[model samples]
Target: MFGDMMGMMGKIKETQQKIEETKKRLDTVLVDEQSNDGLLKVTLTANRQVKTIAIDDSLLEDKEQLEDYLVIVMNKAIEKATAVNEAELSAVTKESMPNIPGMDMFS
Candidate 1:
């Protein structure tokens, strides 16, 4: 029984290490999302920090409209980034434990 417990603990530790490494690797990854019409684009880190934003010159002609479009595009980009982050986290969590009842390890 003790041996089995120790083995389980070791596996838990290994999983923890893998999670940490995945987080570190994710921090360096950037996700790029663009508007459907290609008028705006945004790059965001896996941690959800905005890296860069690109706007087409044509949109500059109308300041108010441009502002509105910017807001819309940025929101879309952020939503996409959030979805991607969630998917990645979910995948990592799933791989770490295939079956564990009442144990929300990633939480």
Candidate 2:
């Protein structure tokens, strides 16, 4: 029983390490989103850190339109980034989890 407990502890530690590494890797993954008309663009890392935002010169003339475009484009970019981040972390976690009964959180 003690041996099994020790092995499980070690596996859990290893999984934690892998999760951290995966998060770091995700920082390099970029998600790009743009408006339908291609006037506004946003870029974010998989970690959901805003990298850049580009607005067309025409958008500068209309404050309300620019704000609306920003809200839509930014939300889309963040949604994509969140998905990438969650999927990557979930994959790492699911791969490292031990086969213990009732511990199937992913399922």
Candidate 3:
């Protein structure tokens, strides 16, 4: 029983280390999303924070349309970044517990 407990503890420590490493890696990753035939593009961090946005000068003429497109593009960028972050975190969590059934602690 003691040996089993120790093994479990060891596994937990290893999993914790892996999670930390994954988080660090995620911080350095960026996801890009675009709209309006790529006329508008947004870059976001893994944490869904906007990093940058690029807009074509051609769209500047239509102020209302430009505003609407900016909103849409920003939303899409955030959504895409969130989806990617979820996927990456999920993959790491799953890898750490491959045999656990119905274990969605991360989700």
RMSD of 3: 2.8
Per-residue accuracy of model 3 over 1-107 as CA lDDT, tens digit each = 99877775787677788878877787778988888598888888887777888999988999998898889988887887788788877777667754434655754
Clashing pairs in 3: none
**What is residue 85's positional error in candidate 2, in angstroms?**
0.9
* Residue 40 displacement (Å), model 1: 1.4
Worst 10 residues of 1 by lDDT: 98-107
Tens digit per residue, CA lDDT, model 1, 20-82: 877777678888877788888888877688999899999889999788877887787677777
Error of 1 at 56 (Å): 2.1
Q: List all candidate RMSDs to the true structure.
A: 2.8, 1.0, 2.8
For model 2, the superposed segments whose C-alpha errors exceed 4 Å read none
> What C-alpha lDDT, on a 0 to 100 scale, does residue 60 get in candidate 2?
100
lDDT of 2 by residue, 6-96 (tens): 9988998999999999999999999999999999999999999999999999999999999999999999999999999999999988999
Model 2 pairs whose backbones collide: none
Superior candidate under lDDT, 1 versus 3: 3
Global fold similarity of model 1 (TM-score): 0.71
